[model samples]
Target chain A: AQSVTQLDSQVPVFEEAPVELRCNYSSSVSVYLFWYVQYPNQGLQLLLKYLSGSTLVKGINGFEAEFNKSQTSFHLRKPSVHISDTAEYFCAVTPRGTQGGSEKLVFGKGTKLTVNP
Target chain B: NAGVTQTPKFRVLKTGQSMTLLCAQDMNHEYMYWYRQDPGMGLRLIHYSVGEGTTAKGEVPDGYNVSRLKKQNFLLGLESAAPSQTSVYFCASSYTGMGPETQYFGPGTRLLVL
Candidate 1:
């Protein structure tokens, strides 16, 4: 089984300030990582994903995440945040190499990001 | 495309009552999932279907049942509702069961059990 841990439960940042949300995972086999954002009363939206290749992957809304295999981390970062960026973010992971069966994603508790003015 | 959609945007049920949530997708996805969201919990998988007529239990499947009679529709039923079952429900669909496939989600249904 795979599991994800988000170090922070809530993060608050001023508008135009940089922010980072930490995430770590545990899996016996190789895995794929993803970041999803959800606004109030809305469903989740894919922010970015890390399947393979470059350690650093970029996503929409000027957000990026770095996959650190050794550290078992996939932290999401943004150089600058806006009020519109305030939302709950989730980190998820699913193991790779699972053939002929459905692979489910294990998600972290979530980190609520509040971009204040 | 409409992507994924869920019926009954909001519902209220009493303990011991029964209700079903419907999910529909137009993306021709082969994999569909049901999940519940709580205050602190990001989301927990309740049940899933890899294809039509194939439903499987997920991380949290107890107290819930699912059916996938059609490729584009998935149904989640709560035989007996409980106070603990009150939460936001989300449905997602992906093109395949591959690890890298992106899952598209529906607007979500808020259920309140009193």
Candidate 2:
């Protein structure tokens, strides 16, 4: 089994400021990583994913995440944030070959991002 | 087309009550999942189906039952609702294989157990 840990329970930043949400995972074997965003009263939407690619993977809404193999971390970052970026973010992981014939994610406890105006 | 839809956007159930949440996907996806989200807790898998008539337990399966009687629909049922089961439920589906397959989620169903 694989587990994901999000170091931050909440992150608050002023508008136009840069922010980073840290995520770490524990897996005995190779895995896939993903970042998801959930607005108030809405389901989660995929922000980015790390399958097999470059260490730095860009995603929607000007967000990006770097997959660090050695550290077992995939932290999401944004150069600048806006008020609309205030939402709950979750980091998820799945074993390479155990994705229910697809990729099934095991999510973290979530980090609430508050982009203050 | 509707990607994934979960019926009964909100519900209020009492302890020991029974209810079922329906999830339907129009994308012809082969894999479907049920997950619950709570405050400070991200999404936890309740159950999943690889195909019609095949259900598998996920990370958290207690107090829940699932059935995939049709290819496009997956149902999550609570035989005896408990306070612990009050949470937002989400349904997601994805295509099979490694073809950039990412799960598409439903809007969600908010259930409150009193």
Q: Write the residue-wise lDDT of candidate 1 on A1-117 in tens digits.
A: 788999999999999999999999998889989999999888999999999899999999999999999999999999999999999999999888853233578889999999999
Task: Report lDDT (Cα) of residue B13, candidate 2.
Answer: 98
* Candidate 2 residue runs with Cα over 4 Å from true position: A98-104, B97-100
C-alpha RMSD over true interface residues, model 1? 2.0
Compared with the true structure, all predictions reach lDDT values of: 0.94, 0.90
Instruction: Indicate the residue-level lDDT of A49 in model 2.
Output: 94
lDDT for residue A110 in candidate 2, whole number 0-100:
95
lDDT of 2 at B1: 100
* Residue B98 miss distance in model 1 (angstroms): 0.4
lDDT of 1 at B45: 92
TM-score: which candidate is best?
1
